[model samples]
Structures are given as C-alpha cells and as structure tokens.
Target: MAGRNMNVYFQEETYSKIKNLVAKREISRFINEAVEEKLKQRQQQQKEELRKKLIVGYQSRIKNKKLQKILLTYGEMSWEDLSAKLEEQEKNDDNCKK
Candidate 1:
C-alpha cells in the first residue's frame, strides 16, 4: 500500500513511553495498526446500534399491525354488538372467578 507522510503531535510523556515500548522503525506501523483497530471497533459498534434500531422499528411495526387487526375486527361492530360482547366477557370473567 502507498503511504503518505503526516505529522502527529503527542504529549512528551506519552511519546517517551511509546518510544520506550516500540522500536523506532515500527512506531508508525504500531500507531497505524492501533488506529485501524479502533476504527474497526467503532464501525462494529455503529452496525450493532443500527441493528438494534432496526429490531425496535420492526417490533413497533408488528405491534401496530396487531393493533390495526384488533381495531379492524371491532371497528365493524355496532355499539349494541360491542356492548353484548362486553357483557359476555364479563359473565365469562365472573365464571372464571368462581
């Protein structure tokens, strides 16, 4: 791969520590690899966040669809029919309590 020359500033103490930790020739390579790894981690975290958002959106749509189905079922009923259904459900609940 082609490389470009760029100047980077580091704190004196940090730079001294890094110099102590790595050979002079491999410092740039080490920094490059560390940056690449960090970038990959950031990209993976972004993908996971998007996946979670998609899952939540999908679940919301499913919930809305279920709500729509329930509304559609009851929307066709007359007030008297709804009242009768409510009364029947109440009776069933009363029975279940016994």
Candidate 2:
C-alpha cells in the first residue's frame, strides 16, 4: 500500500518511553507495526461480535417460525382447548423445574 506522511504528537513521557524501548532508526517501523497489529485485533473482535449477533438473530427467526407453526396447528381449536393446553404446558414446566 502507498503511504502518506503525517505528523503525530505524543506526550513527552510517552515519547520518552518509546525512545527508550526502540532505536531512533527503527521507531517509525515499530510504531507502524504496533498500529497495524492493534487495528487487526480490533477488526477481529468486531467480526466475532457480528458473528454472535447474526447467530442470535438467526436463532430468534427459527424460534418465531416454530411458534408460528404451533399457533397455526391450534388455529382451529376452541378457546377452551387452547386455555387447557396452556395450563398443561405450565404444569409440565413446573414439574420440570421441580
């Protein structure tokens, strides 16, 4: 990639630390590599977060489809039958918890 020249200012203490850690001839390369590494790490982190969000959204859509199917199956049933079914489901859930 082509590079551009830009001036960057650092605090005196920070500059001193870098000077201490790196030879003057290699300071620019050291800073460039550090910045590139940090950028890559941030990009990877964002990708992972996005992947997790996509998985959650996909699972939510699947759950909605399953719920829709259940509702459709019960569409022709009477209100009393639906209420009884709900009660039975709640009882089963309670039993599982116990």
Candidate 3:
C-alpha cells in the first residue's frame, strides 16, 4: 500500500533486535505490520472492556427498585409508546432539576 514517511524512535536493544532480525530494507514494513497488529489488538481489547461494562451497568439497572417500578408501570405499553413516555418523563425530570 502507498504510505507516508515518518521518523520513530526505539530503545537501543529493541532497535538492534529489529535490525538484526529483519532484512535491512524491510525494517519499515516489519515495524508498520507490528504496529498495525498491536493497534488492532488494543482496539479489540477496548471493545471487550466496554461490552463488559455495559453488561454490568444493565445488571445494576435491573436490580434498581425505582427502575423496576418504572418498567412495571410502562411495561403494558407498546414498545414505541413506552419509549415516548420515558423520553417525556426524562424531559420533565430535566425541567424539574433546573
């Protein structure tokens, strides 16, 4: 793929290892591939962490008595109607807080 040139610094030992392990001219490609892989791994790790947090949040909400009461009161409504009711309630709440 086409790319731009930039400078990157590596510690002495790490630099020496890469230089010795890769073909002299392929150092840039080796580093680019390594960086891309590391970025992908980190992004995947972050997504998994967020998913776990969301599950925890949802579990906590399920255990809330207030939320349970609200759900029970609105549960009989159609999903679309219930959403509208909840949004209206939220707006009323924000107005009250002000």
RMSD of each: 6.0, 8.1, 10.8
In terms of lDDT, the poorest run of 10 residues in model 2 is: 1-10
Model 3 residue-pair collision total: 0
Candidate no. 1 TM-score: 0.66
Q: How many angstroms is residue 81 displaced in model 1 relative to the true structure, after the best TM-score fit?
A: 20
Per-candidate TM-scores read 0.66, 0.65, 0.66
Question: Considering lDDT, where higher is better, how would the candidates rank from best to worst?
Answer: 1, 2, 3
Q: Pick the candidate with the highest lDDT.
A: 1
lDDT string for model 2 (1-98, tens) is 57887799999999999999999998988989999999999999999999999999999988799788888889978999989999999999999999
Which residue pairs does candidate 2 place in steric collision? none
Query: Tens-digit lDDT track for model 3 on 1-98?
Result: 89999988899999999988999999988999999999999999999999999999988987897978977887778989988987999999999999
On TM-score, the stronger of 2 and 3 is 3
Compose the digit string of candidate 1's lDDT tens values, residues 4-76. 8899999999999999999999999999999899999999999999999999999999879978998998999
Ranking by TM-score: 3, 1, 2
